[model samples]
Target: MKQRLEADKMDSAQTVSAFVQTTRDKVSVINNKLQRLLDGYLDQLIDQETYKQEKNKLVSSKKSLEENLLTLERTQTGWIEPFSKWIDQAENLPAVAECGTLLEQKSAAKLLFGSNLQLSASEASGTAQSPWDFLQETKNSFKNSEIFADCAILEPKVGLEPTTCGLRYRCSTR
Candidate 1:
């Protein structure tokens, strides 16, 4: 599985690399043409009006190609490892919350809270990110609602087994 993942990553990068090469080649061609155009204008081989028009078109093309190349380069797969590590850490957050060490809890908090993490008054508090924040909002809304106030365990009417209740939530590897 690891080998396949590595191969897939390489394949994805290969496609981007191929396109980057093509774009670089196009840019090089444009630059060469531009230099020749300048030479023509300087040598009086081309009129000023014609030189200006051609230069404008080539400059526009070069700028666009450069921008595209920059974007493609920025999208490289260098972030995959760190993101996978983060996912692993995130999946273990429930365990961290349950019985992990203080350092582990701090790490988990920072992962969930991002830059909003704050340590004050002997307590940690912050705005959570994404699904966590959504989960908090859902929990608060439910806790404040009258419909679920008297209810703790949600029992099925006829068949299903009762599951553990409360706002207790856990993160899963999936």
Candidate 2:
């Protein structure tokens, strides 16, 4: 039975990995199209600078999508790693038109409360509130916001840096 369960989990992981790969391929194709469009505009084929600017946005969007696909693949494998991988990807992307990120939402909410938000592993052992509760509350906030409703990841606070004790909230108008 244990062997069967392990095999089932492995199969699930394989399925998720395949899905991630397919999603990555789609995002890559879109990114390539955007790149080509941008190149054409730069070469004066498109004529409108605005068109080039819009196409350039695909660079970051494609990158974030790729990162998210990778993160999902990791999650499907039963790993509970920190969300920094996705956050790092977003941070590296160019901020263009409105697009949201899940990591950003959690980080923004964490920032609003405090920066050093950490879910105590020991909480899982007792009747303490689950860490996900905080996230849920933050998600509620995102739904009601007028501007910068998308979530954003924040840089972890170091010694003497202004930080919150719980999840952080960072609202950006840009």
Q: Which candidate is the best by TM-score?
A: 1
Compute each candidate's TM-score over C-alphas. 0.53, 0.39
| Candidate lDDT (C-alpha), each | 0.76, 0.57
Q: Which window of 10 residues has the lowest lDDT sum in candidate 2?
A: 123-132
Candidate 2, residues 17-64, lDDT tens digits: the string is: 788878878897987788788788779877786785766677778878
Tell me each candidate's RMSD, in Å, in order. Answer: 12.6, 20.8
Best by lDDT: 1
Cα deviation of 7 in candidate 1 (Å)? 4.3
What is candidate 1's TM-score against the reference? 0.53
Which residue runs does candidate 1 get wrong by more than 4 Å?
1-8, 78-82, 94-98, 106-174
Clashes of each: 0, 19
Model 2 bad stretches (over 4 Å): 79-174
